[model samples]
Target: MKDFPSCFGENGVQIADSSSSSSSSSSSISKAAQNLVTCVYQCKLRGRLSFIVLTWTKHLMGQGLSLQIQNSTSQSLCKVDIKPWLFSKKKGSKIFEIESSKMEIHWDLTNAKFGCGPEPEEGFFVAVVFDRELIFFVGDSPSEKIAAVSAAAAVFVARREHVFGKKLYSAKAQFSEKGETHNVSIECDTSGGLKEPSLVIRIDSKTAMQIKRLKWKFRGNDTIVVDGIPVQVMWDVHNWLFGNSAMSSAVFMFQTHKSSGSHSQSSVLNSSSSSSSSSSSYCQQQIKDSKLQGLDFSLILYAWRNE
Candidate 1:
């Protein structure tokens, strides 16, 4: 899969080059650890399937939001950026054209309430209308003006978030479109004077997966069952184990996969190698293939350690 940092693109955040000076590399990675959340939804635009990407960022001025619509081939159709300085322009609409179809985006965050994260907890509405038809809608209270289009209901496909904590990192995820939201907690003890560092993952306060001897198995994958659904958990923590802890962030992926008579959970875990290269390749292939069928849900987490 593409590294979580790449999803931010030019707006902000990027992976540092290996050849860069140590100080420069540290600055780059530190910038990427900022608070941000990106969500992907699959919906129909002009009767054709498309992907809508929404990114929420937190900065010194205030919160920022950006929207991008892309075709099946991942080509950008159009994009809009609502800067943090434009806080007074809370409620507005943007008009554009895509393939001769008039596309309109309306957002109202006048009373939007937010917690520690960039995403709003409630009191907001963002609607996407194509040719005057409501194709996508999000937020707790949608505007009373926009009518709904049944055929254009979007599917929640993927999410990427940056979480920070000392030892226990937590986030919320829904494995399927209709699935229940569950609390996800990742705990790893890597303090000094500790001989053996281990990793533990919990869902809704219940242990789902655990790893021992994390130093040796810094990168690996396993299968866990949550809400009777099989979720493939892959993690890469080489940086936290050996690299610069202050500037490095570990990655975790939780993906729900379909089970067939010929395929077994054991096979999936066994085929996975304890190396970053193999793990990355497997994840990219799975995501790329599943997007075509729209049958899987992916949750990616970038965990930053607190110094």
Candidate 2:
């Protein structure tokens, strides 16, 4: 066994090639071994293998739905195609059903540029099935992760409320280090639609998972009070270390025309309504010395399931 380079794990095993064999055979074995390692690592990190077992043994045993990391990176991901396999295995069987209205992708970025540019400096992609509305995040970092998670959770809660025909009033969001928690207050109507329901999402500083930073943009017909005119506006949310410390703003205002025939003047406003408790000195240092740029990077994300 010593002659066989071995790597053992609770989940699987890896056997490396041995040079004490015929030259041609050894080369082939070495290549095969390397490929196996790559495949195994990808499967472990993407969580596909674990999900497959859970689907089959869910009722017979006790196990939290968890994924093992064989290898992880920003560009590539591989795992057991559980959903498709389940479909294939369940052909002609009416015993089980899975229901979800939407699927989404989330990216976890380890290193990024986040520089002043028209496009995101760097990020990753993630895909998952949810209760409603397919969502996708372009960047992956602590802040981006928090935003994506919060959005997913909120969308789920909103879908549930919609089912009972509740009247929702408003939706607001907050974040923390603990995790993304949402508080939605709705008037249960038993009817099929809502009149006035409100949702407030809170993200703590703790459960950011493995994200390191985040940034986002909101575009649409959003207006806010500025001086006296109701100015059209957009927002940006930036966070690092998850929601532990962050900055958010809806300060950008549309600039109205000043020339003849134009009635309103508008311009974008950037408010520094930061959520970070740290002083300005710390923020400056963070911006200057951030480590999210310049790295030979690879990340594999389970951007989609078999289904």
Candidate 3:
């Protein structure tokens, strides 16, 4: 697995590649591995403020979900993996120890409703309880809300989306918990031997921002508006402009507020969250150094250019 430092480029994060796939097969194994969505939450676990990372992935083999929690001190609170290959692993509760505190994790996805991605859109509930107080949840249904009210509050801080496209990339985002999902589209033409490429970002089919001189401004940031809310935008088109076969991906970021996080890191986690039998300091270090404090929502995009 490539560490964040080595895998990330200046323009965007590189997501996936498959050298084994035949060109005739449009959606190859490599393409399926890149379909991923991740959510990060800033919450308190056992009175220790922490960042919890939840990732949902889709591949030709199957679907998977995983969670990792790290505290302010960069201690690993817990990590869980759900693979439905076996019937016994579908829905269950887990108990673990963090700082001598019994952490309870409850998840029920057997009856969950899923969208195109591995993430369940509804009909599911996952909770983390520390010292018997609910700390985090992944649902907003009425029942989920009631349970959340009794638990310690957590904030949705950021999201990392892995998307595939040729020239035009599209995705959906909810700036806030109460905000409506908006259509986000990124259009850039770096091919056709144009002396200077251009980039355009649109929300709801309305152009929010554009960059005309791409060569000089391959890595830069701007701001846009969605549902009357202001969003900060950042782009890195280095790969689309100067990449060889080994490096052919760009990355973009859309955020509601300014945050201090590692731009060099890709949201797609290739490391095992359950590998360590002792500590999760490495994983926590990545999230801790991200400096996501006081930030609300961040959308990190890893844009891979298809050749």
TM-score of 1: 0.83
Cα lDDT tens digits, model 1, 177-296, are: 677999999999887574688899999999988888787777766778876777878787776777654656778988776552222243233213545454455555544544343236
- Tens digit per residue, CA lDDT, model 2, 1-307: 0122112222223322222243434334332222111111112222222111111111112111111122212222222221222223211111111222222222332343333211234553223323332222233444433344534221110000001111222222211213233332222111213332111211122221111112211111132222232322222222111222121111111211112232223222222334432322332222222112211111111000000
After superposing candidate 3, which stretches have Cα over 4 Å from the reference?
1-33, 84-88, 140-149, 258-294
Q: Against the true structure, what is each candidate's TM-score?
A: 0.83, 0.17, 0.74
Better of 1 and 3 by lDDT: 1
lDDT of candidate 1 at residue 167, scale 0 to 100: 90
Scored against the true structure, residue 14 in model 2 reaches a CA lDDT of 31
What's the true lDDT of residue 266 in model 2? 29
| Residue 171 alpha-carbon offset, candidate 1, angstroms | 0.3
Model 3 TM-score?
0.74
Over 1-307, each residue of candidate 3 has an lDDT whose tens digit, in order, gives 1122211111112222222233423334336437667777777554545777777776555667777776654455688988635444656788998778887877877677877867888877778887777888776443543364476667877677666678888888898778898889999888857356789999889998888777666665565666665566766676577655533556677766443232332232211432232112332333333334333577877676676
Computed on alpha carbons, the lDDT of every model, listed in order, comes to 0.71, 0.22, 0.63
The candidate with the higher TM-score, 1 or 2, is: 1
> Candidate 1: lDDT of 65?
81
